[model samples]
Target: MLVGSPKVRMPPGPRGPAALNTLRLVQRPVESMIGWRRRYGDIFTVRLLVFGTGVYVSDLDEIKAMFTGDQSSLRAGEANAPLAPVLGSRSVLILDGPEHLRQRRLLLPPFQGSAVERFREVIAEVAEAEVARWSVGDRFRMRDRMRELTFEVIVRAVFGVTDPARIERLRSALVAVIDSQAVLLVPGALRRDLGGVGPWAAFQRRKRAADALLYEEIEHRRRDDDLGERSDVLSLLLRARDEDGRPLSDAELRDELMTLLLAGHETTATSLAFAFDLLPRHPRVLARLRDELAGGGADYLGAVVSETMRIRPVLDAAERTLTEPRTVCGWDLPAGIRVYPAILAVQHRPDLYPEPGRFRPERFLAEDPPPYAWIPFGGGIRRCIGAALAQAEMAEVIRTVVERVDLEPVRPEPEPVVIRGITMVPRHGTPVRVARITG
Candidate 1:
């Protein structure tokens, strides 16, 4: 059993000058986390301008306990308040306790089971169409292409919108809101809408325009008598009822839909971009993956996706704020302290993954990593609801690309990973050349 004095103050960490640590975090998150772990063991604290003196834990057992702890003891929603401007106050990402559960349940059906299976054809079709647009010898940023492809897929399959003009309009509005999100990283930028000029005002304007479109879509769905015939996520959400037999309010629907659209496409596209970047660098792995695809085997493809996420997770860590005082890794942390499960650090630990820097999909096929050791989508009840769809989308895209076209890195050296707002993406956006199409 674990042993430590309960009265000990919070774990050892950087007594930071705040701004420096925040800069390090934004600029070089993986390097900073790993460096801290080496100096302070598996758990440590770092203060940021927004979240003061937050504790970061890389120990797998502690991460498991914290994620599985009672809802009352940890508040993920409160910890994620910084995301409120983009996702809205009622989004599942920002709802706590019973409300989160209710919204999650209402949102779960469309991304699970048969509903997810039905999306496979749509994903493959989109991938094929997007891949067809690339010409041999063309050098392009794979992330940008993946973003366009994933955005188109989500806008059609998830939003239930098929009109070309309406899809383009939604896409433009979302891009404005997404592109302007870097302002949130400025610490106090989310506090209020200045409403006059500059980035904050621009963000508010973009958000208002996007929200107007979403609210209009929700209202239209509510009034549509043929909603039962639709297969999109919005349609499923529209049909959902709580135990009390109540449907979601228009605001609630807007929050959830916006949450899915933003979260679903961006992260998955980044992951795909990383996979494309990694695959060409390791020719043997690429050959094996292609062989697996040709043989109608999917296990290797799944492993590739798993390894990609494990190696280069988009989010550096999953964070939660303590709602009740608790002891973790022998340190007594008070309520309101933000605790982060260092996903990137833990996944890169040499003990958990031998030769941690190598891109080896076979590592996943050899043996499953321990429970919390492989948390690309996070853990416990608050795990990503779009996990299934994301995995399926990645797998389908990889298969389609490998089967149809031959791509190689534009340069022999790999591109560096850089932070884009909350996600880590290839610095040059994974530029690659389409050597040729096999068929």
Candidate 2:
């Protein structure tokens, strides 16, 4: 799409010191986005140390056009380079143009609805085991439990790592990398390896260890005699081939595995954490969800997950780079500009969602939600590959936990949202007390 140069203009935005902008973003990104949208309108610019020129878009029509825009013009891989250190430079998340399409097409089949459905039992079993270990009547951080639960499910169902020793080994290495908190390139000497001892050094060590295990797994899976018959994601990936019939190389396989591991676990776990935190605090929703779960139907359970993500999206925005000058949302964006789909702002729009502040699952259940309106899994071609799997995991886990026990918020008020790594999670991990164990 092209527009007259006179009609196309740079969107209005905040002009400030980069450090101040970065600080506001780091401190309260969701709030900052909403404030910026109000101040600067539907589309605006935010300059951060990380993203040189960030343009955020929240209008539904504009988001739809941008998402479905020419892939060559809107390159997500360049915008997602910040994740390359962890997901790898070859990861589908960090590849653009024909290369990105090749990776995405090859990676899409295993995460299809039918393939993900086969793992419901795995999700249930993992969630049940974790929930069972929770001590009744004691306050605990739900995020910790959810993280452990999601990580185990991913290891078993995605990697097919059922062996106790291997599972523990992979788990240890992965946790070290994930918990390091500098994967996205933090500031100053902290972002560099200081004689192999500081945060950056520790991250480098953990990443190396994790990479070793992942490479070993890839090599083993490639050699599996019954690789085609295996139902795990890694096995499916092993069998996947491009149009030219070439299989993924060890490096490609390793990066994709890392993408699935990092993208799949913490994001889902954080969503589950938010669900658990929100459910007990809003007794009406909890009671209704339990009533639906008792009937062995997930219609309402699905709505609850949708509502939770709507209210508390784990990731605030998704970024795309303007590879060529293009008109987006009436703003003439230049090449090299980073355009962000403001998920948090769009999801919370009062016009789209009445009483947007309140926790309401009925909003989703009552109507066919508008497109590009509730994009927790993002939208269009660059949408999350594991969207179906993530939602299924959330439903099964929530079903497993709610049916097995009763819970109450440790504090009367809702937990404050805080930025943790790439995800926005509950500040105190959404503390909760188990009132009783039903099963």
Candidate 3:
């Protein structure tokens, strides 16, 4: 417990001019965060147009407290309201307390143990097939290709949809929905449709098209007698029942499925994009990674994934809203205050990671990072359920790419990181050339 004078107030932070701060964040999220941390120490507050006032904490102890604190007092779901337009109000990302736990319990089995291994095989197959489509000496956007691969992997592995036409329909709809997500950053934009001409209206149109397909699939699957024996996430979810033996409703199923599709594919694809972007810049690291893949050593591959996540985490922070007043790191916070665990800042702390900007997979090989020091997947009960699957997919894809093809950066300089919806992605989509077909 942090002891302090009773008069101690909230941590130092930027005041007023919320629009300017929000613009700064929108334009350069990672740089703005680092600047504020340097100027204001471990904990600071920033006012934003969409989220109002938010306190960002980079202190490891404070972050742990926020993650492990009483569930009744901290609500991560509420903090995720901005995503509700796409994920739906009933999604696991928007539900809190007992409801969140129940949904989490129902969703856990499909992402763990043997289930993840099965997903890994599906990911490998998808990567190999996608790689086969890439011609040697062709220049392409790595992130776009990665997104297509990850999207297909999740659709097949999670949804169990095998029809090419159906898959294409879902793919088109999902892409449109994802591409239009920027409207979410604009307050009240999602609420006003503006007669089908505005961004919000366009998004709604795409969402409805996607929802129809998802619902059709769900209804069809519910009638299948063999659902119980299937291993995909949708199958498992359809068969799940709560303590009272009640199955999830169709609406519940739709929201959860959408959540998995978006969260599962988007972040993993971005992580791979960053990995590809970084590897070409460091020949020694790339050589070591290739050697590890060729020699069938998985540890180095895992380390590379870990290192990529540490350096370029897709989501800048994990957030929770306070339900009651609490003292964190000697700062008295009021109820309803939003607190952000600055994952990006914490992972880059010089004391925790020397020369943090350098891409060094060996740092992970040296020893495990301290608890909460390297939390790309956040932490505690709200930690990303897809963490294991994401890591596995990244390793398998990296290995497949390195074994089958040689790659080089399309430009001399590294791509800039830019904010896309809630994620940080390479501005130029990580352009690279397929130098040759190695195998």
True-structure lDDT of candidate 3: 0.87
lDDT per residue as tens, model 2, 166-227: 99999999888766655555665467787777767777888999999998998888798988
Q: How far is candidate 3 from the true structure (C-alpha RMSD, Å)?
A: 3.1
lDDT by candidate, in order shown: 0.87, 0.84, 0.87
Worst 10 residues of 3 by lDDT: 1-10
RMSD versus native structure for model 2:
3.2
Q: Where's the lowest-lDDT run of ten residues in candidate 1?
A: 1-10
Q: Would you list the clashing residue pairs of candidate 3? A: none
TM-score of 1: 0.92
- Pairs that collide in candidate 1 are none
How many steric overlaps are in each model, in order? 0, 0, 0
Question: TM-score: which candidate is best?
Answer: 3
